[model samples]
Target: MQYHYEFILATMAVLGILFLFTFFKTVLPIRRNRMFRWLLVAESVTLIFNVLSTWYNSSFGQVPLIVINTFDVLFFIGFVSRDFLFYCYIESLVQERAPAIRLPRFLVWTVVEVSLLLILTSPWSGIVYSINDSGYHIGRFYRLVLYTNAYSYLLFSIGIVLAAISRNVLARIERFSLIGACLILVVGNIMRMLYPTYLLMDSFYMISILVMYLSFQNPDLYIERKTGLLNQSAALSILQEFGKRETFSVFALVLDDFSENRRLYGVRQMDAGLRIIADYLRTRYPDCFIAYLEEGRFMLIARQVLPVTTMCRDFDRRLQEPWHDIHVSLYLTASYVAFCGPLQVERPDIFLNYVATALRRAEEENQLVVIDEQERQRADHDAKIRAAVDWAITNNTVEVYYQPLYGTKEQRIIGAEALSRIVDPELGMISPGEFIQVAERSGSITQLGEQVFEKVCAFLAHQDAVALGIEKINVNLSPIQCRDERMPERLLAIAGNHHIDLSRFKLEITESALADRNVLQNNMKRLQEQHAVFSLDDFGTGYSNLMRVLRFPFSDVKLDMSFVQAYFSRHNRLLPAIIDGFQSFGVQVTAEGVETREMARELTRLGCSILQGYYFSKPLPEKEFLAYVARTQHDPEHTIRF
Candidate 1:
């Protein structure tokens, strides 16, 4: 019996040393997680108590069973305390963000209250010990103590299950480790309960320590090193498995200016920005499966059909929001395609390919474009448009049409916006929207814009006498065309060569052009210095932020047709506010696409200086536009009708 005590002491001492080393190693890396550190402290205390109990039993003469039972109670308390710490550690691990200190407080207090109640009742009060003449003593309440120990182990086992369900990825892995420890505790307690005299069951506690050592040794097994939202490989495997199940909607959000950001800010700062974005996405869309797809791009998978438009808009807003001593300008676009058909259970790689195709199409169009089978067919249509664009560039198939901008009070044409018309001869006239996009994509817009500018300058020069009555001739500029460093100089040179006054020429830039503030500012400054006026065209069409409008230098602001159309609607308050806002900036306002007397009346009431639309006259060829201008000038009282 004495030899059994000595063996137990030696075994526990060795196990305690190993457990201490493992705890120190694991805790070093995760020192920031205060709960995990506390767990190690609790574990160390329990191991110390185990060693103390073994030593107290072996060194002393045959002690009373009651004294041994007191040590047994202390051992049980230590076990319970250690198990509670394990639960806390597991919960902390899975969260990975911040540990909930209150939860462990509640749990520990509850356990202490229960233990105090059992102690006050003194369940083993009268049956302290049974000593025979042989001096070998045994406690009468041994079975009751064994039952209490078993109950404690059962509580810990339930805790493991609870922790498993409550945690995130990191917490779940820690829960797994806790579950392993709990199982060993349960088995050891059960073995001791069945055979009270058995000291061999102490080996199971050593096994639990060994399991903890294995769990703590590998950092990769526990915490995600990058983005700190589970690692990419782990997420990919899970996503692959999930794809094998029911249908899900996958979204691939590609940040357009990620490379620009990387160049502007170093790689380290870029990574930090990505992590912040990841954390925001994870918190907001908890159910959505998200991962870093590549540099400046992320992939999201959802069990439900996510509102892609709303999500994309919200995400863009969030990324652009001011953060920590830095205000980032995020140029983000997201494209998503839902899977509900036979391809529901397709491989993740294949699904990702389809998503990539959709993203590419969206980026090409610079809009949130979806790629269904119908959209795929449009790709073929787009190819035809591309061919037309190619012909237009080489053969000068793009015809220049002029739209007259008439002054309501003056009853005369003040300017004309140069519009492009594509006549394929074979396919006839193509829609401007359809072909212009292709031209922009094919890099033909730079040449196309120059051609249009040259023609307008020449037409102005030839009609200088007749056009002197007109204040300015406005030529629309594509956002892509504005980026070219040579565009302003080239346009000024062409006007100078044609002997046309640059003051008589106004270049109309879209609201979208304001998105690139640096380019817009530089071009506007250079053009203004050349005595050319700048006008904001299609103002309310794309991302009409009031702040951006205030920043731009504009001689005129063209209120888009959508706002003009809405002027007659019940919510007409916005129209006046928009007009007043631009006018307040000392910018002249032009109401575009005015098709009704009511719209014209509304604009006139709001003090709109210039008006253009079907109400005046449709965009006409050069010869027809001249004739229309002549007729309008001659007949002041003629009410134009389409």
Candidate 2:
């Protein structure tokens, strides 16, 4: 049979180009990329040996029997290994998306080993192929090996399809693309079995390689367009692999005033400046993995501990010099953070969070920040707390605790303040101060505040606070929530759902919330129309003034705990002066943090009509708060002594 070799040569040429590009240009040390490069190598070797076997077989007795046997055995070996390599490449893709789904290595390797054994002994046993003096002949077991390869392709397709269906991480297009690659190989296998003289399988290999390359191995997917460097996605993938298997170091570069520079230089010039920085890192540190995390953030990762002091000094000096080639000598201020560790963390997301936090600290302190073990632990704890906050808000499990307000003259509970709390199953009793800030930073405060308001209204609907001598309950509003123009409407809707009276609820606002006077005024007006009372909370701590206080229609003003403690410690005249100034405007004074009898008595004598502190009662759950209110009704002054 005369075999056509033109198509085989052409396909090999194309495969060679792809192999070179994948090896040299797109060598991202991610699992998928490495597996893809392996597939390319396997395919190229298979084609080269297939072409050699065809040539030697065509010469017949001209070539030595040893040469014929060697080329035929090598060709079969490459052929059998090609399907296993394809399976490995798909496994890499699946594992990347669903890291938990591990295909058993032993089962597949067992079949591959048996196939190789049959091929290795084929020259003597005639199990796979035989190169006699006449020509190369398919042995009795050649069909067996071909069928095994076909089944392997079928198994790979089935597994990829299942992974696509089960793992939401695998998109439909990606799953189908993987299955398509498998189907192409299967079809090529069938054609080779049917027409052995066509030499068509290599062409199919090229097509399959093209499909896999476009689907997963394309360099553009992992490169940032603006800076032409490895992107955030690539960095995360590499970091995830390294974090699992090896020790590494990460040097983070954050532009301190990226926004300011972009505004001054315009988008195009700033992007160009970023590209220049990326190029500098790439050229200066060829051994390091460079990634651009957009908005003037870049990362250089190395397998060993970087020379922190020297590298930072070099980068600092380079940054100090003005950038050339731009119309203006573009000046960029950057903050650098270096981290070296075994970093025994399982998830790369947490490590990336640590990097982000470290970058922020470096920018704030205007110095290089080398993260120590304590900082790493803190960052890990913060990530966990943030995740817990998310879980609480998402599950609507945020609890509300009430702290009772004591009227000086009445000497009983007048009202209570509702505080949000989360008791995580794993992390018990997270501090309100800690989780509240996390919620606010993560923009979950809106949902958190809404849940608290609903729970408070539910409490009012069921508990009968008025009968308990509690006139109103104070609910604090987050500044982020207050900024929303529809905050009043959302709160009212929640309250209205439970048929609670707004007049019985005093919405507390912080001094910081007053930064946006227009939004605050609008929200206050809308809520006030519903008979909601407004109070200035934590006053005399932030940027508080009588004028700012009077600007908003606050029916009550609460002195900050710090001021109360300071007055008790130093007998500060400013405390009484501020109290008198607030009282003169007919804004009722409520003193916070009256932690002792003396502080309480002095604050009461200072003409504060309302007193709230640990001395009276610490924040309590609903049942305890109601029980305390009931006790205060009888022995209002001595019910709960500090």
TM-score of each: 0.48, 0.68
TM-score for candidate 1: 0.48
**lDDT score, candidate 1, position 6:** 44
Residue 366 CA error for candidate 2 (Å)?
Answer: 7.9
Q: Kindly list the per-residue Cα lDDT of model 1 for residues 1-642, writing each as its tens digit.
A: 442434366556756676555555432223223544464455555555555655555545566656654664565465555555555554434333222322445655566456534533342552423334343344565455445544553564455456545644334565677577767877877776675444555566667655655664343543354565544444444455455456556666766656556655666767766777788888888887676766565676666777877787786676565433365443343443343322342334444455555666666666775546765456546666777888877886578898888776775677788888888866688988777877876688888888888888878777752543567778889888887767888887788899877787778898767767798789889988878788888877766666768787887888888777766776456878877877787888898988877877768778788999887778888888777776766666653432
- Top candidate by lDDT: 2
Task: Per model, state how many residue pairs clash.
Answer: 3, 0
RMSD of each: 20.3, 6.7
